[model samples]
Target: MPNQNDSDSNIHALLIGIDNYSSTSLFKSLEGAVRDINLVEAFLKNTLKLPTERIRRLIAPNREDTVLLVARSAHEPEPTYENIVKAFTELTEAAQPGEQIYIHYSGHGGRATTIYSDLKGEGQSDEGIVPMDIGQPDGRYLRDVELATLLKRMTDKGLVVTVILDSCHSGGTTRGDYAIRSSGETDTAIRPRESLVGSREELINNWRSLTEGIHRTAWIPVSRDYVVLAACRPTESAYEYSVNGKERHGALTYWMLDTLNTLPGTLTYKALHDRVGAKIQSKFPSQLPMLLGEGDRAIFGTNRISTHYTVTVLQVNASQQRVKLNAGLANGLDSGTRFAIFPFNTADFANKQKQVAIVEVTDIEASSATARVLAEVEGGIGVKGQIEPGAPALLLAAPTDLVRRVRFHDQKQLGEAENELPTQALVDQQKEALDAVRQALAGNGWVMEVQPGEEGHYQVALGKNGEYEICIGMPIKNLNPPLMFRDAAAPREVVQRLVHLTKYQSVQELDNPASELMDALEFILLDQNKQPFPNPSNITLKHGTKAYLRVKNTASQALNVAVLDLEPTWQISQIPLRGNNAAFYELAPQETADIPLRFTAPEGAAYQQAKEMLKLFATRGAADFRWLRLPPLDHVIEKQHEATRGIQSAFGKLLEAVGTEPNAAPVMTRAAVYEPDPNADWVTKQIQVTIVPESLLPD
Candidate 1:
């Protein structure tokens, strides 16, 4: 053995061996050379604390840095010992001081000395890896002494070198049936070798022929500092089983990788063997992890591992318009980093909430850069976008009418006081528009009422006498965040102006000699509330009675005369009023339309006849089915026609004529009053009346 040297500060390791020969090349096997090399590299980097950036990997002819000599030539023809030596020499020259270098090889092995046979000729074989340099002169195989010398030289320099050999060597040696063919072959199939070892003699002969005293080191104890783990004993052959899954390596590699980070500490050469042995034993119960080494040395380093964390959303402070969250250490998360917020579907917020788009952080004073962000969700029609922290983002709604209160979904009224409430201006505009609609309808005899809805919304209801139900509904507030509105109403005087039934009735006798007869005419004025406006002044009118009718237009807009469709016979002269166009003018509040009426009494008993005729036509329950509803008639005869047909055939015709005529004769008998129904419609009411002797008038 060579002596140790001082230049040993730069410790290095060389792990070399062939996984197979031409007969059993390692390149194509389950635990192939490539797999073992890759495994060892990973073991050092991940399990041994070696930084991946600092490691250099070399493989055969593809990478010229390392010699490909150890690889099978049948599989990889470019590899040769000379090239390998050249590369190693260069590596030695470039190596840095105090640097620990590791070199690994996992392939075929050979022993003793023999002449090498190639396609060309024979040559000296120096423990040469088979199939790389074929056909040479001399055909001399390397002796055990020569190989030992090389190992001694490396050890003497204080470099840690690990060499692993997994191949058949002798007869008595335990050998596996595993075999591999070169990749170059068209049919590179794996099969069992025919050769078998039975006794120690055959084993001894095989060992002696490879190298003199090659098994010498196998008998000595190993050192912890330098190590070598072989696949088999000196007299045994390394074997491999099929790796069943998607694994690239055999059992040994699999166990190492799986347990590397899981293991308690660095696997010193000896400890590695024990651990691997335990693993293998637990699995196979027959095989053990093999070990070969010298000197004691610690193997790997501690503190080499990997880690994982979660992101969660905290409080979403809408008033401030900011979200808060807790964040631990993480990657790719910063204040300005963009993030998308989606509703949590797992629990309380289970897909019920809407998801917002991506947003960037404007400020991050309280939370970490990676902290979860909260987004403000807006409601109402066409609402979108996120709200900032502590911002006013609620949708505000107000009632459209003063009579009703605004209520939330929970039925809570929205108000600050008994009458006044907090609301947006938009609600007020909505109310104004709504009131305009109500007034317009009211002018045409439609009774309307408006009520405030939740969130400044408004509800409109039409009375039984009104024209339509669903009024024009619009949001007072815009369909954006901070939605709000207020209430509005129609002009007060417009609501107040009406037909004064009480005043009309109170002066009945002043305008008519027959006060009791005129007193029977009931009158009512319906207000905006649809409630009856009490007419305290009961009034009535008789034939030839003169009464002045007054009408007032108290609206903010122009009032159409068509609204007051009055009965004829009451001659009316419209008087001009201030603050309004007498023709088509906008009438200001409290303006009155003075209307005068003229009536003329009939000759003889004409007044009595007109009164009876008017009464007959005016009763809801028919006083005379033979008569039509008509305005009170005048003194002048419209035009009389002689009896074209006798009263019998013309009776029905006369009743029908009464309906068509503005002024017709009164029903003088009970038979005339209660005429037989022609259409037989039950909706039509008929009543019986008898003309008494008192009803007749003297000429």
Candidate 2:
């Protein structure tokens, strides 16, 4: 890694944080922006040892509270539009070639109508950061277009830059007690044309000159000179919640600093972003942090730490010989999950000599887990010491008999009238059906039944219509309608559907933290005309429109690739491999594979528009993902093909064990049936597509 001590003088930072807005009614005051700035400034000054003279801060502190005030001169300006632009200009002029620049912005973000005529036809609103003086007559936002141009000026001077925006551009309202980081308005009045940094024509001309006529109609040029770390997606809200049980701070900033403080060594931008994202999602699942542009580069162009699939030890309990980890149910951790502990500074965990101990999970929370040490190495006077906090725990083995919990609710009784109770025959029939369901799931290793109030992956209710209704265990806004199955459906068949639903949820959460191929694999979505979609997340496809997937293997080695379509109607099917008899298609290094796809809406008027996801799994070897495949919930299961005879690979056996019949044992001993290959790795990427009825399309 590039030594921070070696280039302390060459680093320049511009930190902008706004907490006290001029328009309190229009834009709510924030409690975290100034605090975020203070945390980041301390990280730079104390951790990186950067000189005070090289750091510049523009802050709008709350006048009421003197406790959280940061020491600054009276001449220091607030983070107004003009002052922010001037800061960029000063940094560009003062920084020499090959020097690094760090920019951090924490404030309200808003979306407004575009002022430029050329961008009006794009049908997308402009996103910008709200200045502290946004309510003033001459105040205006620093639009993304203008911000891109400013960053381009610095990048054009051969300077490296990294920007962190702890604000979101949409969904302004508060969720529960968490305060959102948006202006809470999307009106055209927010676009201050008169207060723009430069004339529209001048800004467009500068963009054109910088890009050398390429992407001429593009509003924001895709540049490799800088990396942007955004708090959340455009449609999601960035939140300011209480951190460490006291002070409020941006969720992204808090986790980013935590990861940096606990990091064993230097990490690349992509790895750092991934770690921060995992931590943030455990608390705020809706807010997904994004890494854009030049993610392959190391932080500040420093040497990079390779990715490792390991969980950090947060606390050590010497009395119980147990330790707390930073991952739990949210991260798919379960009891009996085994991990191989390594020293805090061990670079390569694959080396057996660096192993410090072995532990198994005993207790779990939403975001944390506790594990008891089963064995440890004897090094009292020798080389490596005992286990400690900040150590990395690499997953070795999970429980072979994993079960997906489902809460079963019998709502049929509520439909019966008080005076018109059902007959004994009817009651007996319902009892028989319930007994069948219990028998079907009795010993199935995949799914288990829970009471109404217990935590589960899905909720299954017997409706008055004599059909089983299944919905997500924790339903949020805008989820698809509940899946229904007729009363005549076989009990085993319902069990199969539940298993498939659990598998789908698992596949969505599957990730390899140690995989080196973070951004190397690309899954591009192409429209009917074979044109690539500009934004895959927002893609909308009408019924009968033929789509395609272009999988690019940018990694250095060949990989076995499989794509599974998770339909809106609750079906998981793999796209067949063209002209390949093998279970998975192998794509050579630097190769691309184009596969045709067809997405149709579910057969129901209620499903006018639904969202589906295409999950792509790339592995170093052939791993049979066929175990994840299933027909729609209403479809009857048919014995189409049998499992391949003879020996099975470790992954294949693992899947086989998961899909075992109910007649098999309910639990298995921890006698290692098969030890997973430590070096074997895989990565998964998913792209969501919206399926709409053809009638909804404009002529």
Candidate 3:
């Protein structure tokens, strides 16, 4: 959208093709020369819709032009070095302003080396194409000066000409810096490389003398108006490929036509070359295309008159917004392709707010498809990677439907043992946790479903948090049930605090203009006035700035939650607070906890950047999930860490909890009685914080 087109109106083309050359200097004949010209000519006539008389060709066997019905003029000459030059001069002289000229050459080409002469100059000799009817040792060297001079003359007439040479060329332009090695070499450039009869240095000088107003040392063709698209880089070979059974094509020519015809709209010359180059690399990995002269010129003097979207809005509703898009299974735009509605018309792209409304496609039709507007806010959040949720990631297997919802369940505890917690008490704790989380994440198009008593697409489990294999969160997962039921202020305050936190989360929307913040923690940033910041991409704060972090639980069940700080060096330690009583806290279901952050945004060269990470983890049942290898419960004394225990320690005296034993006997471990559960759902996510760049800071 940030570009424009500048190309001519009228077109004039001179195409040359040679399958067989008479000179021994040509070395070998090409099988696809004529075929390549035929395909290229057809494309110009059909796809470009160019008039036939404006396009002329000179090929071997002296045949009449089939693409143009008009008979050839007496002035039209054969594709000899002399005739090619004459036709080129005529076009340049006659072409008026706003006209485009095309010169396409497909035939024998080679690097000229003077092996027969005793005078050996530098090995750096340029390449040339072999013209017909030359039997002498000198043959016909189509020097770069002739091409460069005529091209300059053409452009002087205010004509935008493009030259596509499908023949061999050496010591020209390069694709640059990328490392590439010759996969292998093939002498398929119509003509084979061979030494000539004269000295290389003298031949280059003689050709340079014919061109005026151009300065260069090398014998390579140079042009500014005549944008040149060479077959390959200076070091590579251009190949002819056999498609299907027998029909052949010059690989570069085939892809060039294929891309131009398939792309829906006109592109700048640079864009077209990029597409063609990519296609050529896919088919022949080693062959790199060369681009010389102007890259920003419009392709064939055509422009996309107006902006177009493959899909358009059809209808809008409270529940969902429907869109009609031409992209389908064939176009390869599958479900989940996001659509956006900007605050202002796209024509004023710079003035519009980024993504005022966003949607994810849910269904497809034959030619058009439908998508659901997932979330919408006034100013809206920037698309994924900025503030919005990115595409969902599925691990292990793909979901049945592309769009999936959240599912919740309390962790299933299997056996019985130790001084266990009551089933009712634990279940009540989990219910409270789930209720809190459910309220916090209310309006972001989240679809919540009760866990299937069986396996399904639902992710994010509510079991004791930090189960090692999944995600970990805050503390208070394991405590005496008596404390929760007590009248103490600390115990009652936890519930009230959770309720207030949920209120904040419930009202939070991504579009609020005041929201802009980042801190190394899984929490929301609230300013001194207690309003949420906008844009989580970067955070800025000065000396007196007051900020608060609201860390919320992801699961429905209560878990022992711990907040630890991870330094840039990967060392882990608890984030010490002056008033917090314990190393970890009992995080109630969906409870939102607050941590006040105090610091100044680093300034000047002394300390330009600073980063800190707070990791939240929760584990149910156990005093500590032994596998974590963290320090002992910091609030308690007697300190050697304990061994990992099983479900016996997690569940109390409810034998019916496992099953109503029909034998009236508690379920016992038996090798034959295998109640096998292969997998369970859990969740994990990452949060990052970055400092605003100095240049982007507020004035």
- Give the candidate number with the greatest TM-score: 2
**Candidate 2 stretches greater than 4 Å from native:** 68-70, 120-123, 175-177, 194-199, 205-223, 262-264, 296-301, 304-346, 353-699
Q: After superposition, how far is residue 171 of candidate 3 from its true place, in Å?
A: 12
lDDT of 3 by residue, 442-493 (tens): 4322233435574333332233221211111222232213223223343233
TM-scores vs. true structure, each candidate: 0.29, 0.52, 0.38
Which sequence of candidate numbers ranks them by lDDT, best first?
2, 3, 1
- List runs of model 1 lying over 4 Å from the truth: 1-31, 46-79, 96-101, 112-131, 134-144, 166-225, 244-251, 281-289, 294-296, 300-699
- Every candidate's lDDT: 0.30, 0.65, 0.43
Report the error of model 2 at residue 688, Å. Answer: 22
Name the lDDT value of residue 296 in candidate 2.
49
What ranking emerges by TM-score with the best candidate at the front?
2, 3, 1
